[model samples]
Target chain A: MDTNPLDNASPGHGPVVALFVTCLADLLRPSVAFNSIKLLEQTGCRVVVPLQQTCCGQPAYNSGDYESIIPLAKQLIAALEPADYVVIPSGSCAGMICHHYPQLLDGDWRDRALQVAAKTFEITSFLSDILPIKRGHRAAIKLPSVTYHDSCAGLRELGIKEQPRQLLQELCDTELSELPQTEVCCGFGGTFCAKMPEISAKMVHDKVHSAQTTGATILAGGDLGCLLNIAGRARREGVDLEVRHITELLCGDLDGPAIGEGE
Target chain B: MEQHSDTFLENASKALGNKAQADIRDLLGLFTPLLRNAAVDNFEHFEALRHHVKRVRQHSLDNLDHYLATYEQQALKNGNRVHFANSGDDLNSIVLDICQQHNAQRIAKGKSMITEETGLNDFLQRANLDVMETDLGEYIIQQAGETPSHIVGPALHKSADEVRQLFLQKHDLGERELDNTEDIVGEARQILREHFLKAQVGIIGANALVAEDGYSMLVTNEGNGDLCANLPPVLIICTSVERILPRAEDATAMLRLLVRSATGQSQTCYTSFYSGPRREQDVDGPLETHIVLLDNRRTEILASDYREMLQCIRCGACLNHCPIYNSVGGHAYGSVYMGPMGSVLTPLLSSLEESNALPNACTSCGRCAEVCPAEIPLPDLLRDLRHQETVEKITAPRWRIGLKLHTWLARNPRLYHWLTGVGIHLLHLAGRKRGSFRKLPLAGGWTSQRDFPTPQGKTFMQQYRAQRKQS
Candidate 1:
């Protein structure tokens, strides 16, 4: 690994980015949050985690309980409202706040929701779009050849197809294997995986098969929900492949066993 | 024809379990997107044309009453009789009456999804009239006593071997083996020619109806639509009222997207427009002509929040791109329409109780919306239907309660973190050895299919706070 002195200091004064560790990353995989912060801070930014932040109300929004999503939206807006920028590690959650929050919250809260949404960004896009991280300065980490799965929300809703791939190509010293139908979903639609498991299984099964066809030993994605779903299915079906968040490999923090692989 | 949409889960389960059908599903998954993408790339102005067609359809729908009246007047001037049917049963009875008045038998039919929606073939057969499906895909499914599985390619789910077996059982051809696709096509053509020549009345579906000249447009690859429309003494056109356009130019705008999106062709082999019966100057045409416009709950769809769905041109691009439709095939929808469009339209046209599971089948991937030529936001519409399901209390009470509890907890950040943190810590300890659970309470839907991975020891929020303090 090439250690180029990863520092959290900006060139002169970096923007204050409140790290919005999504509910999935908060509960299931904390490393994604750490890696995201590392990546953000390495590009010269002040990072803070608002303690009051919780779920993004995506579960309720997707389940058609719009009535219940209002307070959650309000909670997110109030907590992240003070930051210069709110950065998210997961695209699904980022997409919810950026695209769905303004639509879900109404009346007086709608303007605040939109304001919060404007500052929110998925981590990779935040580094690339807002901060303009120099490619040569990235820490060079060697990783196994991997195929990237574009989470549907991030890819379609937020136009996040190229930012992560660009980061992996410029930073990582490994082959970026391209999977067929990379834009197709892995069927991990939050509560969707639990509610419609059979269809979800078949979809993820096809996704894994496509990834394997690229001869990639690992699958990397932006969303923890998709990574968990794909990794869990791969493990269940005895497929010999590892899954990881792209940020974990990008931040050079690949010490733990791959997702769904260890005690 | 039959409302088995209530058994969507059972049908999907059965479709998933079949290995041979799985192979066909895989082929379709690979084939359709390639064709559609190639067709789209071939045209430089496809996006612009899509927008124009969307506006035209929207404009027509807005002024639907004026266009309908103009079409009625123009059609009457062109010597064609127009009739309206309020429901599927009414449409069937009107057609039955027309056939009875003509003493019609041996009806040659072109591919018509509206006919399938109304179950007209079975009704006519019950009335002792011979209804022969001339379209090859329709003919194959008809012989098998099955409904069309796809809108455009009715027998797409059937493999060549399946079709061969179906033919061998149904056809009385001599010991000659009919194994190849060419042989099957030849046999079907020969079989259908007899029906085409002897039929007294022909029935075909209109792709679009022009209010300007009272003309109905029919598009086909096999030229069967032409034969059905012109080779009989009386011609009857069946279509939904939503198929009307204000001008022939508007129909042209829609055709640009329809043909390419439906079959990946710049244009179909045969696109014919008919106004009325044969006049004294006409050499070859029907002596009598009639157009039967079916409502069939479409007016309700027009009046409801789902009015955007009426903009659909039945192109099947949404169906082709839908992942769930590819997995389960069209039969699982158990309705005349299938895929994303079907999930939205079936519930509105039929009862929500019968097709409740259709909307839940979506993963909200948004591919259907991405490829829609009509620019219908199908995922949004499906979500609206799901919202309707919740408001109407059609979803299971237990599921609703679970969602309610989740919402309440999510609204309270402290309670949400405390409860989930404890829950994850316990789950991590319980499945530490295996790193996964084969069985779990309240997650049988997930665990039944694959092992649910155990959460890492502490939640990210807990770790983040500790790390922040240490720093």
Candidate 2:
């Protein structure tokens, strides 16, 4: 087999990135990871996935187990430390690393935490804010209509409301529909979904209803936790809709079934 | 008032099912935000004013003891008796002693959450003194023998029909048509006017206690608080120690945000400051003035990570914006201070075990923090309380163990991938036909309300590794 031409490309002129594949994406949908890599490569970046990487420790941190997250935080810091920039697809995980890590870790470890935090960027924001890919670059695939759900952590913690939408509008032929109270939580607050499921269900039910009212066939969001929640409830309610990560549409890879669908 | 905080879920469920309560919540959901938006738009520098008010509150809280001491000294110099109580029980007894010393028979009260917190009305009634709640909302709730639900509009949970029924049942006057809300209000006004004149003592909550001068500021739209203070021979101000401000201007800074936040108005109809009893030149005022400052676990909160909560001006903005409060009105919180503020304060003041569910009931939507005029991080405080619960082993054992196991797996990537890969594969096979699970073993709580989505067959890492080899 011939050597890949992209491999021989020099790294100095392009941004070097470490892909922090969030646990939800890693376990639930592998296409999101591949699409993320495709989008990053299209931007002319050399991306690396550290083998030692696992989760962002948000599940533990948000559950009030600060002590339990320490070892996980240390592992994450070590895994992502060698890259020029760390990019995450999920805003919740990125927020955990960028906004919460410094607060979670203590003393001498805090400086390293801050260093990791300062270099971390959510993928859409990395594309829009850091190395903005201009609009009018259409993807090969087209979606009929899609509504974007702004996950609470992504919206409130990281201020990532417009980055994904701007990218979607720029890269796809899909009509973007806005959901009512889209800034409100879809109730997939990590373990919060399990701890207070009734309240969570009510919130997600309302979210699904709002998305349905927008008459969009596809529901898109950057956070898989929220997508899975809205998708799961829509399936249960017999509401015919597709829920996919925005990266899949942006990268022109809609091969697999939507979230909570076929194996 | 009886506290059903321990049964918060049951109370919330009941409130959610009540049609009338839901209607009231919908009205408030529309009204409060519209008024707040209008108020904000009318004030060109409202955001800057919010920052100024936050700074003023922060400075006051930082030197709370100094301000409280200054307020006490100034109040005493103005010929008002200042009393301090360490607990709610102490506060109730102090008020009782004051009433007994003056042989107070008829007492008029203007919406005081401090008194509600201390159960002062019940205690006074038990002691044979006749107490009347003079605020229109307060009077309706009193006639119905129900507790105040909302802080600003105490009887907000009651609809117009309920108010009509309450007045028809309680009022001794002959059959009068209470057909409209205006007529109901007029009836309450006619009844309360008599109490306002005949009351021997009047008790009111202070919006802020000025330190530069011993002035207790009161904000009311109905003009009842003013009448309650001036008509009675004795006036008693019930407030917490944290309500003290350094100067009158600081109080103004607070009111700028408070009125806009509480009722969506630039200012209440009556904003009066009473420094002491009747002055020599005054036409009409109370003969004796008293200020009762209650600690009620505030000093402890000030010394803790929740010190920022003391800066809250009790504007009820958090309540107005909270989704949970909109879902299941304020009475479900089972605390005098309801919604986001109550969730944090109830657990701190009351037993954590008893009020344990309050913090967990929140969705952490951050709307409360978004609307808080004092810039209090309510979600962070609630998280802190949850952490305390975990540390104290107050949370359910199954959840703790589950979290511990998840933490153990997350810390080890190789093992985590191995196990989660197998788990996801098995789930995919089990759920391939429907793509979701109607019932899950450990996630019954989630599956009971909504189906659990099945994972994709292979883990992303496994697929990535395989794809890299193929390429």
Candidate 3:
């Protein structure tokens, strides 16, 4: 059952997308990429995975190494050229490519960056916006209580806090407790975690503690970096829980992942 | 202790490391959910109120000079003397001069960050005037001889035991044990009561100065602001220029957002409007009122890239929701302003050069912006400031050079990937068996606290393209 409204790429309504498998989806989490494809393709849009796409330069840009970020940015701009829209799964990556990258390439591709930016939508937003297809859950899978952590980028930069949750509500008949500090950062701020270890450790610990208190068996969010941070801390603390991206659960492809299973 | 705009960031950061900041951050994280839930459930009119507050702030910013003048005129018409300060030094002098002219010896102050900005207490203490903070939190920190950590809850960092000890040390009590929150409040109230009644000048911060009313709307949970503004013979208001609103009703929209967003209170227990000096037959109010509009780099901020920073209502929601502030906390930023707003304002009020650490303290998370009733684009503003820091060449030299090198390679992905892949391969080889490294030389911070996982056999991009080709 193709739940995606983007299953058919009608130029009249379907968007030609520059697929941005954000830095995390590109480096750390690959299935989020495959899951992203199934989700986007199901929606009826033409997804183009530009091979020239590299890091959106968020790591460098955030580290105040803007100069180092510019060229990577220019390369990405050139790779996704002529796409009517650019779709990304991760909010942090989407935020970087859509929000910060354009500012870096202000002189040459400023207009192009701005143009691509306007059309760039997160996969969940694309599902909610361009797709809006009725969600078809893969067989009824019962789960214990869970809550959604609104990634800062997805919530603030993209206003994607609700769309994923709205979509997730249909996936299973599970207890959903809105995360207490859902809007607060789980502290995976690219290099910030490295720059300030004590602070980062304490913050991740607190986030895990708060999530645990909700009595939810599963914690989910959009960005993998934050999920990894929370999941790592949850495992380190030996809390009984599973952490997964909203997409993996939305696709019902999530399996065999205990906290810190891969790491 | 003259305030230095330059030392804002370094001071803030160091202060945040005082160990107390962590405790405060933990506490703040706990209390924050309360406000966020209230904001979301306003199911009644949260969005409308958010829009209303945003519109009010926008209106105030555009017609600022006009509103300030209107507030001044209204205040003067109500027999309040209005003086403007272009800098902290000017504000301090105006306050001191007012105190001196009025023969003020002992003063009582409510919680006023602007007074802290002016270093007014230190200034008054230097001149041999006995100054006391009447707010319970302010009084606690005053006794502890520390600056206020959180804006709304100044003594929020201090635990009950610490306060018990501070109160015991400050007062000659044989066995008056501060058992709970109510006891602490009672003790502080009793101590500050005389000061409030007998002080020559009672100073307070105005939440919103209504331009049409010639009055100041001062909000406080304890009603201390009213006492501070009304008790003494000469009452003075030390506030920044942006506190002025178009009318009393305009503030209703903001007040609707402010209290609800601040402490989750539908309305604070006490909301008082003080027009001016007491009328002839008034039972008990100040004989004279003074309005000190403290600019102190605000005009420059208005002229600079940070004009929107003026829209802050000082509700401290940003501090509560800020992850950086939650982790490092406010004191680490070292500037008087801490949290998200401090990261932006500290540089402006202080110096961009000295406060370079402040702007970089953010994760560019939108939590602060989302929770902010004022709807200030805090993350965007922080990024813009960082950009300004880069363009202005105020950032550390190493960062600039590193950025230069990164830009050079990143322009060519093949080269960038080759270099990173080689580096990645070396790291993977170095930590293969363990699947993660507890410590890596280059990223010592990651190693210091936790492990960094080796990028498995292939990066996601590598697998992504291969999978795409197969399809």
* Ranking of all predicted structures according to TM-score, beginning with the best and ending with the worst: 1, 2, 3
TM-score, per-candidate, Cα-based? 0.97, 0.95, 0.86
Report iRMS values in order.
1.9, 2.0, 3.7
lDDT of 1 by residue, B1-471 (tens): 343898988888888999899889888887888888898899999999999989999999999999999999999999999999999999899888988899998899999999999999999999999999999999999999998888999999898888989988999987868778899889899999988999999999999999999999989999999999999998999999999999998888889899889888988999999989999998989999989999999888899889999999999999988889998889999998999999998998899888999988888889998989999999989888888888888878877778878878877777888888888888888876777787889988877777777787788866655664687
Candidate 1 clashes: the total is 1
lDDT for A21 in candidate 2 is 89
Return whichever of 1 and 3 wins on DockQ. 1
Task: Please report how far candidate 3 places residue B72 from its true position, in Å.
Answer: 2.9
- Candidate 2: deviation at residue A101, Å? 1.0
Candidate 3 error regions (>4 Å): A1-17, A38-47, A64-74, A100-111, A127-129, A132-149, A162-180, A209-221, A231-263, B1-25, B281-283, B421-433, B460-471
Chain A TM-score, structure 1: 0.93
TM-score of chain A of each: 0.93, 0.92, 0.88
Q: Write the per-residue lDDT of candidate 1 for residues A1-263, one digit (tens) a residue.
A: 11221132234467878888888888888888888877888778877777777788777677777777787788778878877899998888888888888887778788998888999999889877888666576457888898889998888888998898888877888899899988778878777788778888889999889988999988898998888888888888989888899888887677777788764
What is candidate 2's TM-score against the reference?
0.95
Please state the CAPRI-style docking class of candidate 1.
medium
- What's the CA error at residue A195 for candidate 2, in Å? 1.8
- DockQ, candidate 3, comes to 0.35
